[model samples]
Target: MGNTVIEKIIQAHTADEVAPGRIVWMDLDIRSARDFGGPNVVKNYEREYAGLPLADKSKTYFTFDLCAPACTLKYADNQQACRDFARRNGVEVYDVDSGVGTHVLMEGGLARANGTVVGTDSHMNILGAIGAFGQGMGDVDVTFAFRTGRTWFEVPESVRVVLKGTFKKPTSAKDLTLYLLKVLGTKKIALRSAEFTGPAVAGLSLAGRLTLCSMVTEMAGIIGFIPECGAEARKEIESYTKTPYSPFSPDGDAGYAETIEVDVQGLSPQVAAPPSPTNVKPAVELRGTKIDSGFIGSCTNGRFEDFAEAARLLIGRKVKKGIMLKIVPATRRVYKELLARGILQDLFEAGAIVVNPGCGGCAEGHVGLTGKGEVQISTGNRNFAGKQGKGQTYLASPAVVAASCILGHIAGPEDL
Candidate 1:
């Protein structure tokens, strides 16, 4: 029987003939936890498992994203639990580096080359950067991965997002995703998989793929995958994979419950109207809308490449007089790399504030939050009302966010 790569992987882990839309229990090949939520997951593990050793901890994975340093307090307290648990059962915990987000870390090795992965955090979809069927689950399910190395999934019907045409303007994958959220409301595809195909996606960088899949959760989808394409994809595959790395694509006859095509030609930068990621409009439509704050950071677009993009635009310029711009790296490693590259100095001299990593201004809970009547442009994942501060939050790509900050208003790279 022919099945999609994702379906085949899931079926290999199960004894049944898996089909789309069927709920079935299967073993998890890998599981990861981050500092943001790892401590609590460990606490739950301690409470539920009670001295029971994991069936095979070797398959269990733990990573110390440690970006939210403050949140590590819980991890500190629970380290013994995690360490002892891992030692007792043979789990591998990554503590040496913090290059990217958890989702990025999970895909570091063969984990990305076509496998079924489950994580404790929502952005687990980023594993799709290398063509993996990955999803986020509750701590309970993660705990099960530690014990029995398995979890359950109701195989999702796929939704194909066919990207056509090359980008005519400076629009980014971030803009494409914002437009997507507008097309597919937040709650419409709660447990579906988003499959990106067509020529547009075929040319995108691996970073672009990560950005697209990372935000799939905002649209309420459980999984996102892009069939492998280009040397960019091959480079990522060779980085962590010892096994043979083969690219995957949907069968020509593979089924999709819905399909949407986005044309990138002449696409303008888009912003999510206040209060919702799905509430979006073209940036040009928001001309003359002054913003008090601008942020460029978060796992979605806080990589070194994102920093380089912003620095390229802000090197000789200053943020507008009335505007306050904040730059956050996704992790300390990214922060240090930017510092080494002198991008840090360029950003600060350009009148932007540099802050510690972690969700940053993305979710609006901390770091450079907005005040009443304040308007901000950011590269964070969502712009839902009060998402960053009670003030207005418009989503844009890193370049757009940096350029808009210098202009004190909504603008794109071209406007710079």
Candidate 2:
């Protein structure tokens, strides 16, 4: 039988049996832990091998993006523990100033196309944007990988997802993602691998693909792969690999558990209401829903394009008097680019607050949170109750969040 994207990567990484439902030990190209569960991983590793050397210390990493700069005393101590452990073990830590761990891996080319990576971040599968096999595992699983540089994984069922529309003005990749969330929901995609195909994936930029694959976890799926990389993305990938970039493609007759089709034509801006990411509806339907706060950054949608698009809406307009808008860049690189373009100045003049680059506010440990009984329209993924704050958080695209900041209510940029 033919192989899918996930199957091809599995074959490349392992010498064991390869088939759906088969569990085997595969080599990992990169292993990492974030500030959130990094302390636990350290504890586990020491208990197992106190005086032993790591299997591949050079390939291991720790990212301090979650609650970076130590939001609480416990977090501060935890981060310090990781730093000390990394020092003793000779592993590297990406420090508080570094951006999200997922972004760090790809930007550094540590997780390359057609490779395997495992990390503590649930959204580590975001690496699928570059055609890598990535998974999120518990601290114990990571500890073993730290010791041996390999982990057990079940070859998941592959699902073919055909997207059938092109994006128009004011309608974005996030909307395309939400539209899929509404159509595919959880049951259809849960526990399976989805390979995005069709017109939408043909000309998608790296940023847009990142946004599209970042949310696979919300719907309970395995990695979301966009196997086709644009020329610019290939150049960036090859820059770190120091070689030509050759991508993986599924076989023409690849075996799939199912084939699902999603049509984004005539789709309006979509927003996931409170309590569930799959609980989505059109943005216009929720118009005039009052909001007290706004946020425009997350690993999913915190690229330079996201910020620049928001700046386009805020250039000549000031944020509403009673509302607070927070802008955070995902990486120091993106933050520097924003400064070079004076995007921060435009946002500042519009009464918006620009914070340092990192995974800001999405974890509820940093800024951009809402209070009791308040309402917020955010660009971050997942609006589960109390995830962002006690107040309700409605998930939308960057354009919608920027427009809402100006009107102090749920709004879109198209009619602005």
Candidate 3:
């Protein structure tokens, strides 16, 4: 049998092979619920399929910090329901109020040996970063997970994203993925996996790679994967995957539905315009387009590296007049780290508002939102309609976000 992560998991369950979109009963190793996805799962379990009974309640996991402090009342109620549901059903709830993003919590401390995780959020695909075949589902599928401990799935075709060149500075994994999304089109890779490979991909940090894999859903991917257990992956493995995990890669003869090659050398900061992640253009193309807001936080780019880069650029500079920029670190730990390092003060001194650590302003339902007709540039993952409010949103790299916040317009790091 092949030792690839996906293959291993599939074979472990030994379910019938079926085409994509077909339902088959297979064991699901892990199932995740969060503020956004949990309520629906609970409601569906309580209403639609009343008393179907889960295979193993302990196998189900819940995280309360899905887009925290900035959440709406509906989300708040959903979170409470999730907690109540977990307690009532004997499922373990990880990080009750710690504010860790769902995927981060899973990779950091929730998912266990040779597991499969399904969550309501699309980015749950990020678990694949650690050699798991994670998938995102809607409330309906989640209800199924709660009922049977497993659900059905169509085997998705794979798209090989072979990186051939070293990524240039300011071209982090987030940028590379956005660049790929532009190349692939938003719906082009719908219901498929982008199996990342090549020397270039192997060289990136695990955190960087995770960010790339997490956003696959924005392009409508079923999931994303990179060969696991490299020196680069050791950092994550040390903290998450124990038990001598052997990484997996596709065989030379492995079948793939498509292959897309990209040369990332000299790839500068890129941006995704309003309404779609695939609507991309270079940051340089955005020069002089005035912005009313600049934000630097989200599951996609709210890491320590991202904040450090933003601080480096905004250390002594003040945000441009009429601009309201905010930083919402993805988790409480990141918030404390920045506070301890005094980066939070620097950001405040630079005229940026540092909101509570959560999914707030990034999703348009929180402390900072662009007013009507306002224009904002952000380091968030998506810019779908109504995201960040009824305004124009441009999704850019952290460097671009910092620089644009400083200049009050779309500008590159050098331009700042």
Candidate 4:
């Protein structure tokens, strides 16, 4: 059988023919951990390696993005330990105000296309947008990558997702991803790799591709793959995929465990209701559902394009009375760029509470926490019960969240 993109990538790393279900040790190009997993990874590395030095400090990265600025003393201590370890080991660390770990890695050009990257955060799969093989693992696995230069994996079967049509305006990559989750149902793709193909894939920007891949974690996917586009239209993306690193594409006759087609031309904005990312519904169906707050940022949909789209709808408008709106950039560079463009000023004038770039509010007990009996619409990836506090959370695109903030209800940009 012909090899899928993932299988080809694995073969390139192993220098041997590989197939799904086979275990192989692959050299890692990047190994990363964020605050939540950093300290544990460091502790485990010390305990296991003892006097042995890390395989290569330049290949590892540490970031303080979760609970950044330290929501509690314990969090602060954990971050300090991570900083100390990074300094001692000479590993690069992105501290507070730097940005989400994935964003930092992508924006800094540290994550190379066709490379293998493993991280302590599940959403590390987002790096697949650049044609890299990225997967999430436990702290112990991260420590193993630190101690040695390689990690092992069982090649995963591929799911072929063919995108046929362009998304309608206000119906973004986020909406399309939610629709996929709703169709496939969470866990159906677990331990499998998703290969995005078809005509529409050629038109998706890197930011859009990043948003699409980010939520594959919700489906328990090992990685999301977007093959190199051969057209001149893809020149920008080619910069990261061409030359020294072997660019990967599935063989024409590649075997796939399943094949699904998505026609985005008719797709509408989608929302995942409380307690599950798969509990998705068309945004219009939930219109007029009152919301106490809304958030317009997360690693999934916090790129500059997301903010620009949201600002287009939110400018000259004010958040509804008694309803709170929170805006967070995914990275410090994105934040500064938005500030230079007055996007932050527009959001601030709209009565939005602009917070630092981090994963703070996505989890409960941090900034933007909701209260009992409240409801919120957010752009965050998950909406599980109590994820953001003692309230119901709905997941939507940035445009949908921004519109809901203005209307005080679940709404789409069309409502404005």
- Give all TM-scores, in the order shown: 0.88, 0.97, 0.90, 0.94
- Each prediction's total of clashing residue pairs, residues at least 3 apart in sequence or on different chains, is 5, 0, 2, 0
Tens digit per residue, CA lDDT, model 3, 171-279: 7777787888888776666777677877657766666776787788788887778873467566655565545556466666665667788777667778898888889
For 1-416, candidate 1 gives per-residue lDDT tens digits of: 34565676677778865888787888777777655455667778888988888766655776654433334454465545555656666777665244345534544563656677777667777777777777777777777777777777788777777777666446787888787788777665567777777766776676677778788888888777777476775665575575656746678787777787767655667887787778889878886688888888776887777888889999999899978888877766667879999999999999988876555765423365788899888887877677666788888888888888888888887787
lDDT of each residue in 190-267, candidate 4, tens digit only: 889999886566667767788889999898888898785534425545554454434587888999999988666778
Judged by whole-model lDDT over C-alpha atoms, candidate 1 comes out at 0.72
Winner on lDDT (2 vs 3): 2
How far out, in Å, is residue 334 in model 2?
Answer: 0.8
In order of lDDT, best first, we have 2, 4, 3, 1
Flag regions of model 3 displaced more than 4 Å.
1-5, 18-23, 48-53, 70-72, 94-96, 112-114, 228-233, 242-245, 362-368
Q: Report lDDT per candidate.
A: 0.72, 0.88, 0.73, 0.83
Model 1 residue runs over 4 Å out of place are 64-67, 71-100, 103-107, 187-190, 240-244, 362-368
lDDT-wise, the better of 2 and 4 is: 2
* Candidate 2 stretches greater than 4 Å from native: 235-242
Record all residue pairs in model 1 with backbone atoms less than 3 Å apart, i.e. clashing.
27-150, 28-150, 273-279, 275-385, 364-388
Candidate 2 per-residue lDDT, tens place, 1-416, comes to 89999999988889999999999889998999988889999999889889998999999999888887788998999999999999999999999998888988887878888899999988899889888888998899898999999988899999999988776868888888887888888888899999998877766777788888999988899989986677866766676567787768999999999999888766789898898889999999999899998999998889988999999999999999999999888888888989999999999999998988778877855676878898988888888888777899998999999999999999999658
lDDT value, residue 335 of candidate 2 = 88
Better of 1 and 2 by TM-score: 2
Candidates arranged by TM-score, highest first: 2, 4, 3, 1
Q: What TM-score does model 4 achieve against the real structure?
A: 0.94
